[model samples]
Structures are given as C-alpha cells and as structure tokens.
Target: MTHQQILDKLSSKYLVKSIDEDVARLTYYAMCFEKDHNSQFEYIFPKLMLRWNCVLNADKNTVTDHYRLITILALCIHLHKYGFADKDLTAEALKAIDKLNEAVVLSDDFFRKSEEIKKIISSLPVPLKRKPSIPENITFYREKDVVSIQLGNRFYAAYIHRLTGVNESPVIEFYNGVFDKVPTIQELEKLNAKGRVYNDGTERISHFSVSGMKFLPDLANQIKLISACVEQKPPHQHLEKSVGLYIVMDIFKLQDEIKSIFKT
Candidate 1:
C-alpha cells in the first residue's frame, strides 16, 4: 500500500469517529514489530517500512508504487549508511566495478610504515553496491540515473548517463571528510557559529524531532529528494506534496515532544 492508501485507511477506520491514537499507533506497531523481528528502531522508526513491505509483497508492474518506494528508501538507507553509519560500502563496491579500472591511486595507505586503513574500514559500514547496467532500448526501463554519491567521501559518481571520461572520487567521501573536520556541536555553539546545513541558519522550516538536536525536516528533505529521483518516470506532483505534508505532520507531533523535553 502507498502511504496515501495507509493514511486513507487510517482516517476511515479511526480518525473520523474516534480520537483514540491507539489504533493508528497499534497498526504501525503490528506492521513493524508483530510481523518482523528484524525491524529495528522501536517507537522512533521511520514508518516508511510499514508501506514498503506492503508494496514489495504485491505482484508485477502493479507493484510500481512499491518499486518507487524502495528506490527512495534505498537512497535514504544509503545516506544513513554513509553518514551516521560507515563510509566504505560505496567505495568498496566501486572498486570491484570493471569500468572503474582507471581509479587513481590517490593516498595509498602506507601501512608498510603506519596506520592500517583496512581495519578502520572494516569497522565502518559495508561498501556501496554496484548499479546493474541497463540495456539500451530495454524491456525493463531504468530510471534516469542521477548521481548518488557519498558526499562526505569526496568522490561523486556521474549517475544517469555514462560519462565517457572523468577523474574524481564520490562526493560523499569528501562530504564525510569535511563534516568530520568541522567543529563539534558544543564547539560551534561556544563560537556562536551557525550551520550551513540547511541554510545560513536563518531559514528554519517547521520540522519534527528525534534526538534533542536533530529535527524531522532533516529526514523529510532527504525523503523528498530521494522520492523525486526514484521513479521509473518523473515523480508526480502529489508524490512530492505528500512527502512535504507528511513532514509537516511529523513536526506537529514533534512539537509536543520538544515541549516535554523542556518541561520542568
């Protein structure tokens, strides 16, 4: 089921007649936990998983919605894997790719003398998986390939079109590197500095929260971008708007959490 379908069912079954939050919450609980023990992030997990498995289990092109859904989810998973997780998955995957033989031997680990990079990488996230090549004039159409790079890793991939010639690593590598180099949150606050993350710290969108510092809009924008790029065709207007609205709704719920956190 698409998120809209789930929401529609939710409204009909619970929202219209009763104020009980349990039904909606319980359904989510069942969808994730009661059904799948592998499901992580109790209570605070992104509900995308609920609709995702539903779509995946459906048959055929009929599951078009689910394919699009997985595309975005994969990207988000990629982001988490890259950022809060590990930076090496994409790199290792790229290394095994045949076309990438021209990879420059940039900064080879001098383990013959000093630090061992492999051990460090093993402790990080797994490598990025290679994108399967799509045949030209194909039966199964590939979405226009846009680059999904490890921004922190410094190398960026030319996603859609096969760039005939290029020299660089994925951007995620660099992005990850730069962020690691940035001052810690406490240090930034002490310096009275602002972040360039969303904007110059002035354009605060209404957003939801998880931890005390990170807000839901952070996740929302990531979802929005991933959704747009995931489709076999361009994303529909409603798809984009739906993501935005969902984000707004998250913030509404998030507001109370913030209040409780600050309460005496």
Candidate 2:
C-alpha cells in the first residue's frame, strides 16, 4: 500500500481500538497531512520547523523499518495543536484568524504575529532528525526494485524506496486485489491469532492481549488474514498492501498533530 493507501486502510474506525485508538487516528490524519503538507501551512509549519527532529533517527535495521521512520517524520514532524479531533487548538486558532480577518483591515504585522505565535506554540521540544539514507539490500535476491514485486504499495516499501533514493514509479498492480488462493474464513480464523493495541471507537479487534483468537468478523480480521496469507508466501508472491504496514502509519499521523498543541 502506498503511504496514502496504508493510511486509508487503517483509518477505518473498525481496525483500531483500546489505548491505541487515539494513536491510530492520529496516524491516519498525519498521513493525509503528508499528502498535502502545505495545504494547511499555518498548521504544519510549526511541526516542520520545531519538533520532528528529536524522536526520529536515521538508523534502522531494515529498509522497511527505515521507511517507517521517515513516514513518521513526515507525519508527526509538525503538530498544529494539542490534538486534531473535535476541538483542536489549530481549529480554535483558525477561528481566531477568522475573527481577526473579519475585521476588514489590519496591519500586516498582525497577520505575521499570528503566524509567529502559532509557530511558537507548535514548536516541538526537540528537532526531528532527517531520516538516514536507505541502506542497500546486501542480501542476494532481496528484490531491490519494488516495481518488480507483485505486492501493491504498502507505505513501508514506497517510503523505503524514497528514503534509499530509489526513484521508481509507484507499484500499482498490487491493489487490483487478487490472490492465487483466497483463504476461507475458517482458514482465516486460524491465522487471526495475533493482536495489537487499537484505539477504536468502533469494535474491531475480537482478540484481546494474549487472548485466544477472539472471533470478531471485522475488517481487522480480513486485513490480518490477507496479511498473513501474503506473508506466508514470498514477498514477491503476495499483494503489496497485505504487508499490514499501514497500521503503523495510521498512528504516526495523529501523533504529529498532537505535537502541534504541545508546541509553545
């Protein structure tokens, strides 16, 4: 799944739950922000300028891991307010601007000050580091070329290619959504043995921590089954998005926005 697609999948309220739900929503929103980073310049500027450098470091164990870091940097590098849901500070600030701008005439400094104040308020406690250069896959047959792989476009692969400085067109064939042998729900249920923290407003995960395969037929199961089926085969043998990397991207996006509120 391309970064956007990964985020889009995880954004479903159905996939997230528990303490992780907030994190997941944050990730989804941040992925959107990365797509159109400058659209809300007033909101994102503070993150880019102030906060991102601290948590992110260039070093990673794998191209997949490295790609994830960059995505997080892109997503959370800038936060606009305390949070993005419901009543975010940025929304309030935007409102403040609407009120101020409605006055018809004002000094350019006033507008400048608004921007300045936002920058200050949204500044990250520490600067985010630039993502490290992508390490070349030294292993033989690692398939350095993402295009050659049948897997569609998980964000990790694409982001890794970008980080490693690989300039290839996005791999879209994976999204056609086909598999050599689609597993039955019975088979899928067997594979749905693992669980992760979800920040879900909607009930998604049927299994709890260390719990047996809780039987909830939500998208989470389908997604995981697809992921497992794909993972069971060679990375080349499966579809791209089934990698399940998007779940992490979903959370990263939200954290970046939250960083904004903590700025000043």
Candidate 3:
C-alpha cells in the first residue's frame, strides 16, 4: 500500500484528520507487521529502527519527538488490534507505549489532552486475519503486453508501457473500443492507430500501475496480460519530485468511472 492510501484509510477509519507523517509511517509498519507476523521480531525491528532513525536524522527537533510519541501510540493500538499479546510485544514496544501514556497525561495538545486520540484508537475496526487479495500466482508483464478486463458481457483491452524515469514502472493504457471477446494484439494495434484510446481526467492516457490496485478482485483477475508483443521504446516525459509519499491508484474507483462512461 502507498503512504497516501495508508493516511487516507487511517483518517477515514478513525474519523480524525490530524495524522502527521510520523503517525502514518508507523501505522504502515504496523500493518506490514500484521501481514508478515511469522517473520519474527528479529527481522522487523531492525527495519523499523532504520526507518525511525532516518526520519529523526533528517529533522532533529522537539516537535519530531512529539510526533514520534504519537506514532508509537498509534502502532501499539494497531498491534493490539492485530491480537498481539504482551509476550508478543518486544521490550522496546512496551516501553514506548508506556512513554506515550505518560506523555498523554501531561500533554497540552487539544487532541491529546482531551483524549480524542485514545477515543479514535479505541474505535479502530476489528482486524482481519489476511491481507488484501492479491493473487498467489502473480504474472508480471512488460511493455507492449496486452491485457483485458471484462465488464458485464463486454471486454476491454489495454497495453502495458513503461514510463521513462530512474524509477520506471509499468503502466496499463486502456483502449476506447469495447469488444465482444478479448481482442488480439494485432486488433488492439489497429485500434491504437485509429486513436481509439481512453484518456483520463487529466487528458493523459488512461494508465495506472496494476500492482497498486487493492480492491475489485474480479477485475484484478481479469486484467492479467493476455499476449506479449514487440517492445517499443517509451516516449520521454518529465517527472516531478513527489513531495510526501507516493499516491496509489484505487482501481475500484477507476472501475466505477469506466462503468459510468460506458453506462454499464
């Protein structure tokens, strides 16, 4: 999950909008722990410490310490929700939580002093036993590969293309034409030449990273690459430096927009 998705989920779930970067990052790690609990603390703790140290090293201030305490509180809350027992929590984790409780008692911040953070923590949803349904046998596709999605009785085609950058990622570009059956690569190529392509709201080609999708399991399964074609060099595009964390596309939301466009 991307950091923005984690922040949005945390905000909506807790009905609180005051989450800072530290809280979001710690919550993300907590979720990662829940997903890979069998990995043991030896593996997870070092990574957590590394992440924590990086943030602290980047900015050393009293405000950073305050955020760190809040993050620790949020992590402990999530860990308990995931059914971690006292024995399961490490000494450091226990100590951090104790520190958070002590800080909360003396803190003057409106959210902390009023115990709103505690209320929000207590209101977290019941934990799930499994992560989001990503197919066990996953297939990674490269540029020029054709994929399909079935919406009702009609099928839509898309082709994969890599963006030009240091951190290039595969993006799926959807065609505008609807098909009675999955179209062949040759047919999609012809359609592409005729300018039969879907453009997103920004007037850019309708594209997204498939790995970022979290919901719409049926659509996810149907969108696997169907055919591989010749690799064409991707066009050059300017990339912007992301300010905070990466934003993940919600494919379920994208599916809704597509359905509305086709009135399906």
Which has the greatest lDDT? Answer: 3
Worst 10-residue lDDT window for candidate 3 reads 212-221
Candidate 1 regions with alpha-carbon error over 4 angstroms: 1-46, 64-76, 79-248, 251-264
Tell me, by TM-score, which candidate is best.
3
User: What does the lDDT read for residue 35 in candidate 2?
Assistant: 44
Candidate 3: global Cα-lDDT?
0.42
| lDDT string, candidate 2, 1-264, tens digits | 122322232232332221123233333444445544334344433333222222123234422332323233224212322122212434443454435445533345545554544444345433222222222222111112221111111111110111111321111111212233333333432322212223442222121011111112321111122231132211222212233322222212323322222221
Candidate 1, number of clashes = 31
- In model 1, the worst 10-residue window by lDDT is 168-177
- TM for every model, in the order presented, reads 0.19, 0.18, 0.35
Please give, for residues 68-124, the per-residue lDDT of candidate 3 as tens digits.
444444444444443332233334444544565566632344323334433434443
Evaluation by lDDT, superior candidate among 2 and 3 = 3
Which residue runs of candidate 3 sit more than 4 Å off their true CA positions?
A: 1-139, 163-169, 193-204, 212-221, 231-248, 260-263
Q: Per-residue lDDT tens digits of candidate 1, residues 78-148? A: 32332222234334323322122233212222212112222332344442233222111111112232222
